[model samples]
Every structure is written in C-alpha cells, then in structure tokens.
Target: FCFKILNFPAEHIMHMAIGTSLSIILVTVTNSMYAHHLNKNIDWNISKKMFFAIVIGALAGGFVSKDLAAKTLEIIFSVYVTLVSIKMLMDVKVERDPKATKDVFYWTVGFIIGFKSTILGIGGGTISIPFLTWRGLPMKKAVGISASLGIPIAMAGVASYIYNGMKISNLPEYSMGYIYLPALVGVVLTSSFFARIGAKLSHNLDQQKLKKAFAIFLMLIALKIFIG
Candidate 1:
C-alpha cells in the first residue's frame, strides 16, 4: 500500500491515511501474538522505553514533507541504518548482564532502532534483537521482547504518517497521505504470516548466524531503496 500511495493520485489523502492505519494495526496485532506465543517473559520497563522511542521517532519521521528532499533523506538514512546493522552483526558478543540499568547505552540503542524503523517499513527487530542480546538477554527473550516492542513502534510510526499525510497539499488520489490501502493490505497479510514463521524459526537457529543473515537482508533492502 505504501508503494501504491507513492504513485497514487494527489487528491486521495484520506485513502492513504486509511492504508497506513490498517498497516500499523496489522503489524501491532501480529507482533503481539508472536510475543505472547513465543516470548512470555518480556521486561516491561524496557518494552515501555522502546515504545516511547518509537512514538517520538515516528512523529518526527512522519512529519517530513514528501518531496525530493524527503526522498533523499530516506535514501541516506537507509544506508546509515544498513551500515549500523552490519556493524552490530559483526560485533556480536554474549551479553552477561540481564538486569542492567537504563543508562546511556539503553536509550541510544532504543532511539536508533525507533528512528530507523520509522524511516524504513521494518518493525525495528533487525536492530533491537542484537542490541537486546548484547545487553545480556537470551536470544529467545530478546526476540520476544523485540516483537512485543514492535507493536508500539508500528502504531506510532503509522499514526504519524497518517496524521502528517492528512496535511499534505495536492496529494494523489486514493491516498490518505503517504499510505496506499491496497498495497498496505497485501503487504500486511503476506508479511504477517511470514513474520510469524520467522519468529518461530529464530528459536531453532544459531543466534549469530541469524543476526548476520538479518543484517545482510537489511543491507540489501537499503541498497534497493537507494537505487530506486
């Protein structure tokens, strides 16, 4: 729906809003379910922090005008995020502290994940998972918590996009702002199922290998966006 929205008639802002809203709803629901069924021991404090970061980041990212400048920013940010993902993957080490304080490290990690998630369509797991594991949480626990944390990130990011989209002038038809319903529906329906499968598979894989694979996938997507 997002891609369609990009090409939709300039007068359909409401449609775009609807599509973005629906996409976020779907993302949240799927993430919640994954958390419940897969990771039942989430740390509420960390989850709350991550959620707040998502909201702030989404609000900021969503408000940017959809112009040549915005597209440029998107490409630049994508490359930066992809590099960060690769760095995290390469520097993987087993975390030894599970009850660490909410210090500078925690906030820095959370902010990066939230900001990148807002710019990209991802749920922030690509960054969150490795950070959590590096902070000492078990891989299963990190995945579960990250999945849960993703709900708020999607909600806030989509909401921001929808809200800002409503204010866009001369937007395309069948768009609410930056959203396109049909595309959103298709992606959500397909991605949700695949995300669940991925979550399940994470449990059976080697943590380091999984992180590297995810990092590579993120980098590829970033390159695609940059080239597009």
Candidate 2:
C-alpha cells in the first residue's frame, strides 16, 4: 500500500513500516498483558524461546537489507506478499499435528519468521499464527504467543534499520535512518482510531470470510505492483 498506492519508495517504506508498527504493537501487547480473560492462554516459555531466536534473525536481516537495492526490495515485497495472499485465499483448515512442536521447532521457525518479517516489514504473526496452530498449538495460544513476539521483532528491526540507514546518503528529508518521520507519524495518528473501529466491527462479521476478502484485496494490490 505504501509503495504502490502512496508513491513511496518500497525499501524505505519497509523501514517505515517496521518503525511505525512498533508503536501500534506496543499498545496491543500491553493490552494483551493486562487483559485478564486472555491471560489463561499465554505460554511465556514458548513466547520467550521464539522471542530470542526471532530477535537474532531480525538483526541479521537488518544488516542484509543495508546492501539490498531498493528495486530488489520492491520485487521481493511484490512476490512475497502475493504468495502470502494466495495462501490466505486457500483458507487451508488448520489441523493439529500432534508431533509438530519439537524442542528446536520454536528456534527454527522463529528465526525464519523474524528474518522474513523484518525484510518485508510485517509482524511475524502473519506467519506465526498458522504455523503454530498447525503444529498442535491452540489457536488462542498461537495468537497470544505471536502477539508477544511482535514487540521484539519490531524493536530489533527498528534498531537495525536506523543504524544501517544512517550510513546511506541522499535519503529523503525527515528521515532518521530509513524511517520517514512524517509517514510514521501519520500511521500513528490514524491506525489506532481505525483499529478500534475494526475491532468492534469484527465481532459482528464472519472472520473467515473477511480474511478471504482481505486476502483478495492484497493480491490485487500486489499484482498491480508486479505489473508496474
């Protein structure tokens, strides 16, 4: 959306998304931590394990992104988001694989989720929820764990993007590293208001159908980007 619709550089938008997402994530996580009803499903052990591994991966991704060309990042985003959207459209029912959670599974999946989420400027939840649910975790538990992990991933990505972006020259105005302050601030101002509206509306909506609709929209946006 930032790149194709908003006319921003895709790579810089990646950095911008990560930076802005952190603020929204902080609010959500904090609310999750305090919500009494949601407390029962949180597995701190799994969350911790994933958190540590993902942070490491996010750091590595940040360094790698430093040398990646803007055009390359644009292509990467287009392809990856397209694939993810298609996967969402498939609506594959999540069946528990009783043996899916091995001791090392968290580390391995966490690393990949962190790396890719950072590179693509997303919360790892897009990948984490489905993977965890398929791996025998309860859906509530998966959501809880993934939400907790978003904080660390975004933090690591933010730090990395800032440090690396500072070294580059001729970046746009009001950028701290690659994060465009105006865009980040704009997101902060608008996201929370709509998020509340979305949350309230979700209760009355068929979530699966909504997700499918959203996935199709994303695919259209991605295809437009790809064609251009």
Candidate 3:
C-alpha cells in the first residue's frame, strides 16, 4: 500500500523488510503474552529446535534481499504474495496425527519458513501453520508455535536490515536504514488496537468467509503492485 499508492520513496523490499519486523515485534509481544496466559497448546520441543535455524535464515534472507534489484525483488514478492493469498482461499482441511519427525527435517522446515518470512515480510504463520499441522500438530498448537517463532525471526530480520542499510545514502527523514519510523508508527498503532478486535470477531464470525475476503484483498494488492 505504501509503495503503490502512497508512493513511498524507498525500495519496496526495504520498506517490507523494516515494516514486517516492526509489526511482528508489536503483534508478537501482545499475542505471545495472551497465548501464554491462556496456556495455548504449543509443541515446545520442535519450537525450540526450529528457533535457532529460523533466526539464522531470517538474517540471511534480509541480507540476500538487500543485494537484489528493486524491480526483481518486487516481482518475486508479488508472485509469492499472490500464491499465499490463493492458498488462503483454498482453505483445505488438514488432519493432526501427532507423529515424530527427524531433527533435520524440522530444521529444514524452520529455515525455509524463516527465509521466506523475511523476503515476503510475514511472521511465517501462513507457511508454518500448514506445515506443522501436516506434520501431526493440532491447529491451535501449530498457530501458537508459529507465533512464538515470530520473535526470533523478527529480531534477526530487523538486525540484518539495519546493518545492511546503515551506510546507504539519500534515505528520507526519520529513517533508520530501510525502516521508515513514521510509517512504522502509523501501522503499529492502528494494527495493535484493531488486532484484538479482529480476534474477538473471529470467534463469532464465519472464518471461511473472512479468510476468503482477506485473500481477495491480498490478491488485489498483488495485482496493483504487479501492474505498477
């Protein structure tokens, strides 16, 4: 939205790299505390193992994105976003088996999700939840674990962007490398307040309908970006 409509002056990848980290930080802080208080079921063993790899992958992703051309990065990101939106619309049913997997497999999954999270500017939930549930975790547990992983991923992503953009010249005012402070503030303030409301409504609303609507919105955003 910022890049296509508001004409943000920074590279699209840079804006996403910064915005995603900041938003994840705020959302994770609020949601993690809430989930912990409520004892939201989580697979701590897998989560612990994945955390290390996820962090490393996030850092690597940020650095990798920094080196890509703006137009190339934008095209890749738009395609990925479009696919994720389509996945949401599909909303296929998944069963939980609660089986075991090799450490190597878990680490691989963690790294892949983490790497994509940074490039796509997400908290990894979209990919993580499906992967976890497919691997025998309950839906609720998968979501909780995904939320927990966001902390490390966000930290690594922010640090990498800060380091990579530190010496870049001609950034706009109130910018920390790729991070635009004013944009971050606006997003955090609005999302933090509305997120709780959305959660509440989710319990009462038709979830499938909501997901479809959100997916349509994302598709539109992707199309807008692709055409510009």
Candidate 4:
C-alpha cells in the first residue's frame, strides 16, 4: 500500500519491508512465547527444515526485489495477495494428514512461503498455517510453528532490505538502509497495543468469522492496488 497505492516517496518499498519485518517480529515473539509457556508443541524438527530453507529464500527474495521495476513488483505482489485472499475467502475443507510431511516437501514449502513473505512484506502465517494444517497437524500447533518461523523470515528480510538499500541515493530522511525510522516507530507503537488486543479478542471471537472478515479486508486492499 505504501509503495504502490499510496505513492510514498523514495524507498517506500524497502520501508515497507523493514517496517513489516519489525512489526511481525514483535508479534511473532510474543505469540510464540505465550504458546511455548503453555507447553504447546512447536514441532522443532519440522521447524528446523523450514527455518533453514526459509531464511535463505527470504534473503534471496529481498535481493531479487531490489532489481525489479516498481510497477512490476506492485503488480506481482497485488496479484499474489489477491489470489491468496480469494483462496482464504473460500470455505474449502481439507482432510487432516496423520503422517509427517517429507523433508523435501517441507523445504520446498518453507522456501516458497519465506520468499513470498519477504516479497510481500508480510509474515508467513497466512500461508504456512494452512499448509501445515493441510499436512495433518492440528490448527493450533500449525499456528505456533508458523509464528516461530516468522523470526528467521523477518530477520533475513530485514537484513536483505538493509543491504539492498544501503547505498541507494535519495531515500527519505531518518532512514536506516530501507527502514524508515518514523514508519517503524509508528507501526511498532500500534502493533504493541493491538497485538495484545487481538490476542485477547481471539479467545472470545468466532475465529471463522474473523477469518472471513480478514479475507474481505485483504480483498479490498487487493482491489485498491489493482485499480491503482
């Protein structure tokens, strides 16, 4: 939104990357910590396969993004997000997998999720949770693992954005590589407060409804981007 639709000034794409990474990092840490405190199973063995592949993909994505034209990137991201939104909006039933996924499959999915997360400047939860659940893990456990995966994805993306923007000329003021300080500060402040509220609300809410609402929201954003 910032870069493509809202027309934020130079380095807005990088700013979005860093800002999103920082915000998701905070949320991921908090959620994963709370889930861990509850003795939830995080599937560390699976996470190991995912983390290794995802981190590399995240870095590669960030670097690859640096070379794309702004319009091209915007179209690609908008289209991808739109398709994901549409998929989430549908009420598709997936059979739970009782068996563990193959190592190659985990690595492949992890890399794709990680790369897309960086390219989209969003966390992998939306993609990973569904994938994990489809692979036969319970929803809660899948969410936990996805949250944990955010750490490496965000870290790699931030580093890559920083590296990509390090020597770019004409970036906005108060910038650290691709990270715009003001944007990061603002998002961090709101994310800290809202994360707690969201956590609390989840316990009381109909998650299916919430998911539908979120899908609608994403659809609107996608429409705006495509129209722009």
**In candidate 3, what are the lDDT values of residues 91-164, reduced to their tens digit?**
77766667788999888988988788777677787788788888887666776677678777877877777676
CA lDDT for candidate 3? 0.72
lDDT of each: 0.63, 0.72, 0.72, 0.73
Candidate 2, 1-89: lDDT as tens digits: 56346665655655555554554554554454434124565678788878888999988887887777766766898898788888888
The RMSD (Cα, Å) of candidate 2 is 3.2
Ten residues in sequence with the least summed lDDT for candidate 4: 10-19
Highest lDDT model number: 4
lDDT of 1 by residue, 28-112 (tens): 5565555455456576677776666667765555554233254555556577768866785777465486756565666667777
Q: Which residue segments of model 3 deviate by more than 4 Å?
A: 3-33, 36-39, 199-205
lDDT, model 4, position 43: 78
* Candidate 1 root-mean-square deviation in Å: 4.3
lDDT of 1: 0.63
* Backbone N/Cα/C clashes per model: 21, 0, 0, 1
Cα miss at 111, model 4 (Å)?
A: 1.1
TM-score (C-alpha) between model 4 and the true structure: 0.86
What candidate 4 gets wrong by more than 4 Å, as runs, is 1-41, 94-97
Per-candidate alpha-carbon RMSD to the true structure: 4.3, 3.2, 2.6, 2.7
What 10-residue stretch in candidate 3 is worst by lDDT?
A: 28-37
